[model samples]
Target: MTTVATSSPVSGARRQAAEGTLGGAPLGPAERAARGKAARARAPRRTHAEYEPAPNRADPIDVIDRQSRSRLPELVPLRYQRMTESPFRFYRGAAAIMAADLAGTPTSGIDVQLCGDAHLLNFRLLGSPERRLVFDINDFDETLPGPWEWDVKRFATSLAIAARANGFGPSQRREIVATAVSAYRTWMHRFATMTNLDVWYAHVDVDEVASRLADVLGGRGSRRLSRATSRARSRDRLRAFTKLTEVVGGERRFASDPPLLIPIDELHTGRERELLMGWLGSIVGRYSDTLSTDRRWLLAQYRLVDFARKVVGVGSVGTRCWVALLLGRDDGDPLLLQIKEAGTSVLADHLPGSEYGNQGERVVAGQRLIQASSDIFLGWQRVEGLDGQRRDFYVRQLQDWKGIADTERMNADDLTLFGRLCAATLARAHARSGDRIAIAAYLGASATFDQAVARFAEAYADQNEADHAALVEAVRTGRVSANEP
Candidate 1:
């Protein structure tokens, strides 16, 4: 790979071009934005629907590690933190697959959330402001654009991991994989033939979805399971949001948590809260542009209600995370947006792509490009933190009722239904960005991709085990620090 000196303005401009930023004369912000957007409208559009394998590429693992070395050191600690959550260090150590799959896949161009870590556990129903059950990918940390196949392979591999973790036999895992592959193939076919507007309007309401699944399953146990999952999801959101902000006559403030929520006593210097508020402004201006024409205006109307550094996600634990509560005409009329640091994409080190100036912005733009629909609040910016490094951040809503499957307790039948949904979601993402017709033709109405992934999963499983062992050694040798809570 060619290294460009980041210090030079010309090289920096070129680097920013890859990031979808344009430069021009010192025009007013409004004029510059209008001109840049018009240029984008007239720009040549190329879709990755037709893809072929690259020739004589370097080994993918080497490429991934090289890119990874340049990433923020905080990312390694974060990855380790999430991995330690389940003693399943293998799963934690091996986000490595995302790189390999991106490097290996045949092409189609897709633009969407990319899920960053697409797996069975990642997708769940989240409540919209209208209390409508809207389904969307809930994670954005590693979110970025690339070969959509990377998400698919990661999702499929995750299913395999969850199935094994849940104690399903290999045959059951294979059957689940087949179901998932089928769903993906079917969904891609459905999505490819869809009109752009139809694709944009797509969202699954959990109630209807549960009812539909109930119709298919048509049994007491299935009904009970569906109900239970729905309740868990709904309750999870409630648990996180109820204490989110205490709304007085018209102002919102977080309900108290002694140390967790940053006590009043902790504000002796008041610098932390000031830095947080500064970051919130960037979230609206930089992150929410991909929102629809109307929604962007509506978002701009809301005033900042409250913000605090809050802990979130397994992998994102301890990373600087903050939630900004936005109140509209009334205090009860609210919007909650989350601004969190964006780490390197799981595929970054592995895929053949230009280096990123800020991997977080890449994550933001990629998600907007690939997801059929995206959060109205999605945007990215860089902010200086106490550590002095300019942290790259992508911001979105917090506790939007986003839930994941209970992988720990799922049975074979549960895996079958859930894995298929995960697979179908992945394919929808890929179909949007990749040449679906060609991929469909390539998949050639067979389970070849499925088989290839399974073999890859098993092989990578060993690698994960080795990586996990290495992580264990790192902890023992004081290469990284942690405290068990």
Candidate 2:
């Protein structure tokens, strides 16, 4: 086995090339492949299988606690409670922990706009701007420019953990992880041969994918896919408006559900309420400036009616998330937009800081670069809080054909198929922002990289189990408080 280098001259050049500022004319495919072969020699593919924790590795619980300091105090425990539900749930909330660990791992030094938190659950069916159902990555909270392998490792490990939750044996688990890695390798190779425009336009249409897999999915998996696609198509703005609002007296208002959803009026009163409403209303106008001309014109038609502080997702429970209800023309025409707080990515400390000053812009820029299609209303802004602190936020439709896969219901075959879909989607995303030819060259036409990543996934899954156990112990001994919401 080749020993990994702490820093290499080749790695530095690769990073510069990945950033598209390598101080030279564009390299042809042959030169690019040479650079990739050099990277492979410097960091052998087999070296990726290693996963021994450093003696001075940070405590996972401490990392969780540090992240909580910036979050709502009351809701931090709920984040912990949600994570403690299972090892898979724990993995979902533990991206920071994994990011810290991945810093010590070997990489090809290839950088891309990473999803940061690329767990399998984050890949799902979403509505494209054209209203077609597409399978793509939906989360960008932790997105940043970093090693492509970090996203791949995070995704593969999530598969291993989820397999364990479903009672899969070690062999079956390895197969599942390898299946995804192989798909990534295969897709990257395919992308290497495509034109830049083609690569940029490549996307997975859920309907097309369903048609392709109809034979292999069998009746059960086929039905599940149909239901998922149906649910996604039904989750448009109208559906969100109907489910989340009610007629209060004479006007539509956000329904109040404590802990999960609290109306703005319920949280503030008197002069404070008046000030908050004004600030939130101003945010709509300010955020609209970030959108394109057509989108801005469209947004100008909607009046901000109501907003609420809502608890959302496992890791994001404590972070400030607001759902705004907007109405156009009359009471019946509505748009639901979510304004979520954006913080520094979990990978920030491990890699270089983001070039965008506002974290919200960082997220928006990343999403636009990586996703083939994005929400029409996606935009960002900075707002001053009642406490006089300023925070960055990104706004988008609250539920635009969003559908998450139910992992618990998936059998081994179902998961393997889902893994393949996620892997291909991830490859397409990476290819858009990184050198596809070089990455494909490093992966080669071999099973070595795939097998090594599968091994690493299983090993890291074991480490994740230990970390989850530590959190559970902390809660049991009252070192950390965990309250179910």
Candidate 3:
């Protein structure tokens, strides 16, 4: 583990902020950093390494079941089955379980709008509004203002688990985790010294990422970089349309894939179809209102052609996700938008409830706050489900140059570079909502916090495997249902 040097002189503005000389200030950067460091008096950094559940800790299965209660019953088994495949997969889908465990861990008492589920897989490449590809935290359904350490811990634990999955030994896993934390600390230091606009514009462009990887790992790095870039470039709207839609009877409609992508007409017919389409039309109307005037006008040019119930993601399989296809000018001109269900964030249990009553709005707000650039069409709406329950949904373009990291195919060196990239991105996200100066100061010139978090990652990875085994046992004993892919 390496310590970040923060020996540079504090700026005059930071000095004023720290000394309470700044108008209407709660505290200065120095004061806050001092307070943050003093937090170790009550909660020693080493204490975070402990992951033993309290005697009365809720059963992981029961917590999962509670989350599934509001989900589509038939699709719930798929979530379980996906999670049951491996400890890494289980970790991805077990945000609720980790939330419980994180609640019992020590904290730095610093809060930030977190990705809440900042696992390694959640960080990916996407197109910015400028159509420039950038790497960022791409998942925000579980985002909320909560303990900053919680997100860091989740990210670190993910690296440990993923390293194990990639056949890296314990020493390599620990080093990878430490490197991630070190990168985060170093970036936070840089951000703390930057102007607000600079921090806002700060992002890891995909080209820069490719160059950095090539510099580090030579030929293997170049190959991975090329693969990711090519994949993202190939996933534009035109390609998605060609792959996910078909022309039938002179009309373009979503292709059917039972239990995953069922077209609206396939699911309803006659009077029911009429009512459903009418309801969907209203949903689109409401969603359009949430967008900016220009975007709304841009969307109005397209006419809705079809929609489908699309199952997506490991943790979000049971959620009500839909893809709507729209045609612009002609059959060849098309647009696709995904309306994904957004429930209360998992962090809600650990922090004060959000001011936004609608979970969709919560997700949208948090995403705009953390992501360097968001989809132009991103919006939110509340809609009534088939079960007569009201649900919140955030809408955006389905796949705009999206490229996800293939962790399963990565070796130890590949995972290391990937971890570094994600850690830096996470630091940027936290800087948007948290006191970066204070955080950087508290982490000053020492590897104490980094090593402690790495230890926690190792312990939590062990706990994750144990919980995964328990789920396996539950499936074996018929205590839970799981459907194999």
The best candidate by lDDT is 2
RMSD of each: 10.4, 6.0, 6.6
Candidate 3 runs further than 4 Å off = 1-23, 26-28
Question: Model 2: C-alpha RMSD to truth?
Answer: 6.0
TM-score versus the correct structure, for each prediction: 0.72, 0.96, 0.93
Q: Regarding lDDT, does 1 or 2 come out ahead? A: 2
- TM-score of decoy 1: 0.72
Ranking by TM-score: 2, 3, 1
Candidate 2 worst ten-residue window by lDDT = 1-10
Residue 213 CA displacement from its true place in model 1, Å:
3.1
Against the reference, the lDDT scores of all candidates come to 0.56, 0.89, 0.85
TM-score of 3: 0.93
lDDT (Cα, tens digit) per residue for candidate 2, span 37-125: 78997789999998999899999999999999999999999999999888999999999999989999999977778999999889988
Model 3 worst lDDT run, 10 consecutive residues:
1-10
Q: What count of clashes does model 3 give?
A: 2
What's the true lDDT of residue 405 in model 2?
A: 91
Residues 31-111, candidate 3, lDDT per residue (tens digit)? Answer: 767766776776776676777777998888888889999898999999999989999999998998898789988887666
